[model samples]
Target: MSVIIDFFDETNEVKEEQIEMIQGLINLTAQMEEVDEAEMSITFVTNERIQELNHQYRGKDQPTDVISFAMEDMGEGEVEIIGEESARLLGDIVISIPRTKEQAEEYGHSFARELGFLSVHGFLHLLGYDHMTEEDEKVMFKKQKEILHAYGLER
Candidate 1:
């Protein structure tokens, strides 16, 4: 599995270690979810851009820290096979850098930690994991915690 991360926006404050943390989150997801072959893109956008996306996609005019567009949700027995030349487009994850920074500060965690959390949450959404109901929230939250713990990011 490969996470085709594409950083955007003018968040030049982002450090190399943070980028590596993002990659580490991807590896943790692949290992925990048993995703053999998958490809996803992660893009960082400004608050204005993310607000537009939220309005267009979710009908929400406010800017969110992150949003996800999932591709496929295979069942347990479903087979995942991809050609060597073909990279399945799993989905796209768009995050608001300014929002994330604010959240990180508010949550008393590192910016990298917040970024990892958003990325993992977006990836899980792509896999059809949602926290709509109590049971669903329990499951999804547990999985999120596990993935974050794997990266040593606990709040």
Candidate 2:
């Protein structure tokens, strides 16, 4: 199993070290999830850009920490993405730097931990994990905690 990650710093807020850290975190998450192969994008954007995306996609005008666009959505049928070199195009994860900073402060955790949380949360969504219900939320959150702890991104 292999995971290919591409980083785009659209807001110019993400540092090189941060990218390295998040990339490792993502790779660890994918390995833990047992994904065979995947190619996904992680884009760091400004609050304004993220808010616009949230409004257009989720019908929410507020800025969110992260938003994921999965290539293989669970529709009536399904959508299989054929990425470069036969790697599956799992999805794109867009994160708001401002929101991440605020959330890290609010949660009293390291910025790296909050960033990992958001990235893992987005990645889990791409893998079809959701928290739309109480039971599902528990399952998803427990998995998140386990992944984070294993990655050494705990609070």
Candidate 3:
């Protein structure tokens, strides 16, 4: 169960503890879901950068709190098959730092809690969780809350 994680961003103000927590979230999400040799990338960006990404990737043209682009097929919690001899790429998680700050204040939660929730939510999507339907939202939201709670990030 090896996971390769890369964090890319130009900001220098992010706390070491926050970085550690986000890395821990990746490991915990992969471990609890039993993924094999997963790889993920996380990028923290400002509103402008995230807005460009949202417009290009999702065609929304707005900055959201977080976005995830999952590459692997999660196979309903069964054996997630990566091609033989090929490393599994889970996906990329892009977070808007400014938006996160605003949402944290708006929702009346700690910045850490909001960030952790977004990280976990994005990780779950990499694990094939979707919030499109009611049932799917229930499962995804429940898993997100559970993981955040397990890490003491729950509101």
In order of appearance, the predictions have TM-scores of 0.84, 0.92, 0.88
Ranking by lDDT: 2, 3, 1
Name the candidate, 1 or 3, with the larger TM-score value: 3
Q: Rate the local accuracy (lDDT) of all candidates.
A: 0.82, 0.89, 0.84
Q: Clashing residue pairs, candidate 2?
A: none
Q: Show model 2 residue runs off by greater than 4 Å.
A: 74-85
**Counting only residues 3 or more apart in sequence or on different chains, how many pairs clash (N, Cα, C under 3 Å) in candidate 1?**
0
lDDT for each residue of candidate 3 in 1-155, tens digit (9 for 90 to 100): 66788888755556889989998877777777887787889898999998998999789988898999997755466685646776678889988888888999999998888888898888888788999999999999988877777777767
Clashes of 2: 0
Give the lDDT of residue 92 in candidate 2: 95
lDDT agreement of model 3 with the native? 0.84
On lDDT, the candidate that comes out on top is 2
> Candidate 1, which segments miss by more than 4 Å at Cα?
73-86
